[model samples]
Target: MTGIAAPGTKVAVTGAAGFIGSHLVEALLGRGCEVVGIDRRSLRSQTLARLHLGDVLDHPRFSWVEGDLTDLNLNEVVDGCMYVFHLAAVPGVRSSWTGFEDYIASNVVATERLLRACREAGTPKLVFASSSSVYGMVDTLSAENDVAMPVSPYGVTKLAGEQICLAYAKRPDSRLSVTALRYFTVYGPRQRPDMAIARILAAALTGEQYTIFGDGTERREFTYVDDVVEATIAAAGVDVPAAVINIGGGSSVSMIDVIGLAREVTGNPVPLTAVPAQPGDVRATAANLSMARLLLGYQPRTDLRTGMTRHAGWMRGLTPHLLRTYAPPPMITGPKEATCSH
Candidate 1:
């Protein structure tokens, strides 16, 4: 309650302990709104524990509800909230390869449940966290109305979530003014370590040999966490009708270039070992953000080089944790070394 205003609008943030969600919580607090944060995992370390505990320590206004959105009493949490940022889910394309049912439950079914609850509570607006993976290596850059061809179950679930939100919008009693922000390769501080650029760069910075899947040729637009968060906030503030906007970094760059940039920033000469491209991986993704520009006034400000520099700097600050997967450094030798080993 301390973070939320006494009489101010209440904003509920799902996945509050997550990278983007935590930052969004801080931003909402900065804006003088009361924040109700919910997350599924308990903190394993003191630092992370404080992220959830310190700001709202014994505060009357801030509320911490520890539960899963799929199982929670949604009405109890969202009852009076003016805005809801649905950021919770089992994330990662590789992750879905093993546990598709988890993705279905968390990303699809859970989202539907939340929408239903929003309808019941007469909630005004919701900002959904979606992925640009829905584009799936399209022949042209994805537009707002393109047929979403999700290559991965994870992407499928996210698209399904958006469709579910849209379906709810069509309902007579559905008062939820929802918007979906299709985020393109978000990176920055607190990035999930499994993500491509961050995970590899993190290992390289720390003198660990990181693995690169496939040749570092696939191009992607890596959006910074701040830019993505800003776009989400912009979507929340705007009156756009059932909008779906692309939030990418200003431009696209190849994985090879990103590796080079990370090496320049970290000054660490970690070795590289190329692996096969994981299933569900897209060759390239470029967002046609004209709709976002016209609707949310969202212009991705960070470029790949700047974003990687910032990401390397952030990873350098963290005390290295044991990464679940092994990573190799960027290969500068030749394109042959960088090609898929599989």
Candidate 2:
């Protein structure tokens, strides 16, 4: 159960075209892994050129499967793989309330299908990209053993996916070693256009109004993307039968403070619009990372300011067309880890 993605290690990643997924693919490739990726989105060459994964297209060991998870020939995507990272899902909290069916299909059904594929392929390690949304509103730092009382349909679906993983891991006939990391507000360069930090940064560039849902006091444990990716890869190698770990950003901050940091990092002021908080939006989220430290040897390396500085640099590198993809959000942001399935 201890494999650190050595040279020529065969790995499979779902949602390879997404923000976090793309980063994971690159990290695996850097480790000399032979990677097979599957995503529902068709990655055109030109579009790929505009995103984080353009160079991966030409790598000798990299291949991609472009199709929905439920319909794809999953054995092609997963067979012979030593590790399978399941990161694909329809993200966002409010949207899930309006489009619960899509959430169920992608997060729940698609996950079940991937689990079955891994079971049949006899994949050694399955790392599931879960979320803090599964915790819902918490009065203190949420830990792995806390009762899951998700307040959003999206959270419910994510919880269902984690439950399914736990069930499969406990099954008598299963050979899967499961590690589900509950990511708390993952952010950095290449964040989805819909996420809070992405919008907050984009608003600085576009001069558009960045909506602040609720007062600006809503706090989130914003773990950097690189930190999350490392924790995930580490989990794949860690010796554990089945475990859930929290990947936190190392610190917590309010939305207002984040906005201020964005302005400081970019040196550009963004107009802010305050609005009443919508349903399913938690007042705050924090993580107790004792398990992460002990289980995966995880410590969040990037703080908000440094991570935001890198994010600003990334945004500055994008062309106007590329920047268009980082369009201002209609609302402020979604749940923590309102990501993946990019």
Candidate 3:
């Protein structure tokens, strides 16, 4: 029940077609593990077009189930699985302000249901993908002990999701050992088109203007996707009783600086359009990774310039039309100026 599930052991990953989930699925398959990838989007879905998992999907050790987490038959998915990595949740902070109910359903209610199902199925361990936004605007590098005061509904629901896992762990008869990883801003190739890095790179490549809210001073501890995947896999295998760990890139960079790095990396000067700061947006985020290192032996390998360079390369390989098709609508800056980037 502890230590990395042995090779050939079935592991279930929700959101398997997502940016991070797809990468995790590939890593698990490479480790000689049997994987069940559960995702709401099918292989044909436009959202998954960038995933590029033809070989992994064809592998004998990988199976996929497309269904909603809220109504999916968890018994069937969790049956005989050694570990469950729950990465399926509605994402985006700006969108959550108006779509709070969807966030609750996906992040909070679905998490509760998944935990209950894991308990019933006798699943031993679960690694939930929590967010660093749960810490809001921290004065120092955020730690697990800090009182969680999420400023946005997205962060609030992620905090609730973590609490649900902890609540289940506290049950007298429960066998589930939950490890919630509070991930800082995860970015790399295949990052959601809505994220800052993705949008910045796309704009740079396509000659489109990229919007920057908050005067380009906002900073984030941008963890690479591969690093997050490593920590997540380590968390699933480690014999931790029940813990919340911070998984971050270990370096904080300002938004304007990131754009400079992107220009240096891609050799494409990205046009910038600055707008008023959006609501629920924090000014800075830096993760205290002492716990992640101590607990999961996690250390981020990719630095900001290197990660951004890789992301730029990946974006360059994509068809121009796909980039335009998947580009997320401009983020809401404020009520006065509903939209900015075009």
Candidate 4:
């Protein structure tokens, strides 16, 4: 948590109101660094309010900009900042199938604009929030150097964004240094309601049937959000000009097993209805953390059971009506349908 950046140094977080971004902003402020948060969500948006940032939202060290990354004045956002964590993107795989244009604008074009502004402002470091989706369906644990054969449009845009960062870093005159972290299945408190764990928890709490897109056998490396934030902060301190590293939980677990664990944690056995596998949905994803260890000394601390238990506990405290309200609409298959978190 310490040595994230110089104390009192200004840092900018693009998706400050998001689950992971909100955690990162809080951590940075706790470390005595000033944070400039940029998000398209209005101050009154439920997304921001539900985070319960409270004092952190009004902290003297925190300032928020209510605007999209595409239209924001990037130069001003990065001005006098030592680091920038680019986490803004139109997240979710299911929605990306029909919303490719929005994905490109948020993930690709917006990243290019930020990189250019960093180059112009001489920002020292930028940690891009890449995703394991970029690896698509891999035969074994995905490494940083593996071919980025992204299967989904969301994955494609994220890969392009990372490429843009590297392209800028390779410039002879560029002063900005970039580190892209391909996070695998990040989850914990404040997880988006649409994600697997959150949905499972909600079903357990409400006695509702949880929909499983595929059989419970699909596996994923569920990295905890706190561990991811640690890796991200560590990435900024590294000297790498341009490097891609995997930020994973150091292990993988089956979706069915996760459901069982949720039942044990929440003490509620929720019914599950399995559906056919959807397009662009990978059967498995695991990350090789060697590069992350070498570069950032990062190691995931939370196990799936422990993390899921915490998520269940957080959900138990929320009002039942609010849980239902946050749940995304039922999934229907079509060329436009897609799902999953980044």
* Lowest-sum lDDT 10-residue window in model 3: 333-342
Candidate 3 lDDT over 156-235, as tens digits, reads 99999999999998888889999999989898888877788888887777777888887887888899888988889999
Error of 4 at 303 (Å): 0.6
Name the TM-score of candidate 3: 0.94
On the 0 to 100 scale, the lDDT of residue 169 in model 1 is 75
TM-score, structure 1 vs. true: 0.88
Cα lDDT of model 2 overall?
0.85
Lowest summed lDDT across 10 adjacent residues in model 2 is found at: 333-342
What are the C-alpha RMSDs, in order, of all predicted structures?
Answer: 5.2, 2.7, 3.0, 1.5
- Candidate 3 residue-pair clash tally: 0
Clash counts for all predictions: 13, 1, 0, 2
Candidate 2 Cα deviation (angstroms), residue 83 = 0.3
Model 2 stretches with alpha carbons more than 4 Å out: 1-3, 45-50, 331-342
Q: Given candidate 3, what's the lDDT at residue 93?
A: 72
Over 4 Å off in model 1, which ranges? 1-7, 44-61, 320-342
Per-residue CA lDDT of candidate 4, range 217-335, in tens?
A: 99989998989988898888878789998999988888989889988998988777778778788999998999988888887899888888888787777776767844544656554
Evaluate model 4: give its TM-score. 0.96
| Model 3 segments more than 4 A misplaced | 1-5, 47-52, 326-331, 334-342
